[model samples]
Target: MKQSTDLPGLIPVFPLPGALLLPRSRLPLHIFEPRYLAMLEDCLKTPHRLIGMVQPNAVPGRDESGLHKIGCAGRVTQFSETEDGRYMITLSGISRFRVQSEVDGFTAYRRCEVSWDGFDQDRAPISDTDCAFDRKVFMRLLDRYFASQDLSADWQTLEDAEDELLINSLSMLLDFSPEDKQALLEAPSLGTRRETLVTLIEYAMRGGEGDVMQ
Candidate 1:
């Protein structure tokens, strides 16, 4: 599929180092920083509360620091405003973005121009064998992974997940290193992404770093 170039109606972004947003996934964020608070205000006045999610190459600290070349743009699907004037928003991933430029960051938040490229939104297929393996092997390992991390999950809903939901949700939930998340974002196809998630799950279950299977 042909990738999308920067369109006229692009949104500003606050780059959060080390986090990645993959297509079809949902990211829940608590907006507390001042610049991001203003960014949310700007988005509220617009038709779509859209923003790009990017990472910084170095650890994020202080003003005007490290940021990476790529990120994803997401639309705010839901928002709840706190009495203290913060926003708790859930963003639904729409497209992948390449960081074009970053604005000055003297203010509380930073902004950037981004372009979407190389992400396909149409439903991609997963083989029955792959899907079954994804369910059985991946879930077993995922349960082990959660236990190792001392976290608990609602397995009932997770067990009923559709293939796409299963893949995307698991990808988002894993405490993968930044590089692993970036690789998942750059995966060629949905099946490939699913396979990557399964590989990560199994590796984490075995207490290993991400391996070549992804």
Candidate 2:
């Protein structure tokens, strides 16, 4: 299902610097800013209220600067309103998009024309190079990683996941640098992405943080 470049149901987007949303993965977000809270409200009003999540290098006057060109569109699948009126929303990524141009809108949320190049509306096929043996090794290391970090995870459910989920979750757990995440986002195929993620994890585990993200 290739999304039309001219898809008519474009929604408001919120750009989050340094976060990457992969397909079939869920990103939890806290929406507290007034502008973003309004965006969440508007999204709730629509059936498919989607927003683009991107990272900015710095915030500018506040220290977090401008945004990166690439981002992923996520739909607000689950949301709740807190006592203080803050919003807790779960963003489920739909697809990747390259920013084409920003649109001037009255709302605080930014709007942009996007091009779906790396991600069409479908998952790229897994390649032969992504062998089962390597995947097993990655899982073993992943278990060690979880244990080392004292993270609670469902191992049974994890064991049932396909290669793609395993790789995506691994990527998130490694907390790869933004640049490295971008590289994974731009990977041409699933096998290649998996391999790159594995390499990144191995490198990070070897005390190579500086080189990992760059």
Candidate 3:
């Protein structure tokens, strides 16, 4: 897939805590809410079918105060509309972005002015040689973490997957706290993300208290 040269200055955002999208990864979303359904309809008419995936700072009920500054921009790669006016869509991550400012919009869903200056590297393919990731230690820690959580994965498939996919997929799929997931999303490099993931797993194994995904 070719990288998008013309990333938009303004983007529609979906702020769901603990839901993560990393560059070159894919996230599947179910759009049923009226505002989001409208957002999707509007996005589908545009040339750039992009949506920003961000995490809310506070839980949905407590406050509607704010969202984290960093997020990943994804393009709608696959979409299906239901007879009941719902959408099941898959977004393929394009790049990571920083929220420069919020742009007030007429739509019920929020919009933001984003800057991708620092995350240009996200536009390129990340290879195993790109960073010093300790795969051996990561796997060991992951094994222990999985056992403790009573989670099972297909080891053969995971081991065969590409480095970037393995790291980002695990980061998105794991049941980490919103803060931890945001931390993973904001990690500057693949190596840094791998290390942070290992640390989180270790902390969980040590009985550290944190909120699980609701």
Which candidate has the highest TM-score of all?
3
Kindly list the per-residue Cα lDDT of model 3 for residues 1-214, writing each as its tens digit. 2344578889999998889999889999999999999889899888989999998886488767688899999999999988998899999999989998889869999999998877867887654233687677778888888999999999998888888889999999988888899999988988888878877888889888874322
Model 3 misplacement above 4 A: 1-5, 59-63, 126-130, 211-214
Instruction: Write one digit per residue (lDDT tens) for candidate 2, span 1-214.
Output: 5355534335566766457787767788888998988888877787667778776556557755455677777778988889999988888767777787777878877777777675663333431234544656767887766675567788888889777676766665556777787777666666878878777767766667464645
Sort all candidates by lDDT, best to worst.
Answer: 3, 2, 1
Pairs of colliding residues, candidate 3:
none
List the candidates' TM-scores in order: 0.78, 0.81, 0.90
| Model 3 C-alpha RMSD to native | 3.1
Superposed Cα deviation of residue 101, candidate 3 (Å): 1.2
lDDT of each: 0.70, 0.70, 0.86
Can you tell me which runs of candidate 2 are displaced by over 4 Å? 5-11, 58-65, 121-133, 147-152, 211-213
Ranking of all candidate structures by their TM-score, best first: 3, 2, 1
Model 1, range 58-168, lDDT digits (tens) per residue?
A: 654654566666677777899998999899998877677677776665545667766564444521233212334546766787788788889999899999987767777
Best by lDDT: 3
> Which residue pairs show collisions in model 1?
17-56, 35-109, 56-67
